[model samples]
Target: MVVNTGLYAFNVTCAHRQITPTVNSIYGDATPPNTPADFEIKVASPSFTRRFFRPQVSFYCDQHSPFKPLPLAQAYALLEWGMNWCIATHDHTRLLVHAAVLVKNNQAIIFPAAPGSGKSTLTAYLAMSGWNLYSDEMAIIDLESGFVSPLYRPVCLKNNSIDLVKQWFPESVFTSTWKDTHKGDVAHLKASSWKQYIQCKPTEIVAVIFPKFVANSDLKIYSLDQLQAFETLSKNAFNYGVLGNLGFKMVDKIIKRAALFEIEFGELCDVQAFLSEDIIR
Candidate 1:
């Protein structure tokens, strides 16, 4: 199947009916049959099906799956992760940063952080609360324009944030929870409207905020210098080393143009207020 992820297209082939529906449910907008696939996935059920104690499924990228088979229930999450891996590894046209992007009125903010940094949780909240989600995992930076493109997919909510997001926005579309993965208890909040994604032009980044969620703490924002921001972003980018000078130029340009900050936030309302009053003008 050829799935067009708005910005990029992927070709996936999976024989399992149990898994296709799940992918379809999350990425139905992209799955239009018979086009060229950017990345091909072929997943197969374990041959040891005779031992029905725990059925498993294996995910293959270009007919090769590096990881071991996972439980049948985790097939969809595996495919999602596989697709993201294929993009990060193969696509080099854009400088990819490990960040969450949110846009409002053609201005965007990039939230770059490490694992367990509450980036995805904040992204899920911003996305559901009147902000357009560019991506939950990647900030695709265009070299020529110095603008970030929207991935326009799901906001992956892991751990407790999954239910927190559900409670905050009951009207949202979410996938079934896949438990015990590398990331604990993962679920994806489908974009509130895929319509917002279709005609997405690259939006200039206004601020690059590194967020760390601290429990029971007040919102704290710290300014980062240009050199500091450059170094920080360079470290967070997946393809920076491979892109060479082009990557450095892009990162430098972004650092020069966008305001840089590191924020430790606890309350969602406080963060939202800060964005509205200070950043999103």
Candidate 2:
């Protein structure tokens, strides 16, 4: 099947026996039919029953099954999200931290946290309000330029967050909840528009926020020093060690330009207001 993403075109073919998705670029003269001049993506597999591949830097998902038929929408969403990860890991050589990105006033703010850290919940709320959503899973940074690239993929809401976000933003667009997967009870929010993906731009890193959700604690924002922030950010990186010295320099440059903080909050509205007043404006 062929998917047109405006900026790039992708062709996905499933294998009859494999479990992983492999990509084969069909650039130049080997481009697929109706391929855009800007980018062409061709994926082939010889081992599965279903597959998905995303050519855009923001997202892609490819999977193979023996007996089960995967939903097309779900497969596309997965490929899109996965492709974002693939691009960040392959192109930038910078650390791909698990986090959510929100942009305001042309500056990008990243929330890096472990699972159950309320990152997605916070991101969903911010997206519904006014902030532009970059991603909810991967933080893509350009290694050479020290800029944050946009990954306009869906925000994966897990467990209780599904109900929490539903109650908070009742009009939000959420994919059907999938059960018993990697992250217990997972649902996705397609909050960003396709225009956001095509017009994706790299922005300066303004703030690094490590958020922790405390049900009863008052919203507290702690100032984090460069060393502490760098250490934590490195730990969250997907390819820090892989990129070596270049990665270190890139991370240092980002830290020098951005203020780092650790936030503890329970209310999304309060957090949003605080970030708007303190960080963005």
Candidate 3:
């Protein structure tokens, strides 16, 4: 089946129906046909060559699998990760960054953080609290326009956050938790409405925030100079090296226009208050 994510499309073949509802929930009601795709992928049960007792499933992109097979129950999460890999490795038209993009009052903020930095948790909180969700993983930056497009997929949660978000937003829909993956307990918060998926225009970015989840800490906000922000963003970007000079120019432009900050917080209310009183306006 071909999945058209508005900006890019791919053809995927599944070994079983395990990934069906996940694809449906993430992409909305319309199913992509099995047409010609930008990239072809498959998720199937791994061969018993190792003769291990555990059942495993592996994802293949254009007949090539990058990582080893995972537990059978994590097929859906593997598919999502595989799709992200396909885009990161192949998609060069947009300046892909390992960042979560969210917008409010016509202004967007991009959060670039390493794993365990609370990026996705903050994204889930802001997205549920009325901010527009562009993406929870990759931020597709239009090189020419310097605007970020919406992927409108699910917000991935890991470990304790899966339950934390569930308790916070009882109405939010999420996939079954897949435990013991490389990301440690992975689940995706599905796009809440079709309107969100259809609101696909590239949004202007106003801030670049590096969020750090500091336990039992007061809200600490620090300014990031353009050079600091640029260096950090370049490290987090997926296609910067592939895009060459175009990538440099684009990142430079982005740094000039957006306010850069590093924030450390323990509570969601502190984040909400900060963004509302200071950032959003």
Clashes of each: 2, 16, 0
Give the per-residue lDDT of model 2 (tens digit) for 49-120. Answer: 334442111122334222223343334334544454444445444557667888888889999999888999
lDDT sort, best first: 3, 1, 2
What is the Cα-based lDDT of residue 174 in candidate 3? Answer: 91
The per-residue C-alpha lDDT of model 1 at residue 130 equals 86
Which digits, one per residue and each the tens of the lDDT, describe model 1 over residues 1-281?
66667766777777567877777777786536344566777666756671265878777887677778888888888878877888888889999999999988789999999999999989888887888889999999998999999875788889999898899888888999999998889998886566777657789999999999999999999999999999999999999999999999999999999989999999988888899889988
Best by lDDT: 3
Error of 2 at 193 (Å): 0.8
Ranked by lDDT, the better of candidates 1 and 2 is 1
Q: Between prediction 1 and prediction 3, which has the larger lDDT?
A: 3
TM-score of each: 0.94, 0.74, 0.94
> Which residue runs does candidate 2 get wrong by more than 4 Å?
2-10, 14-85, 92-95
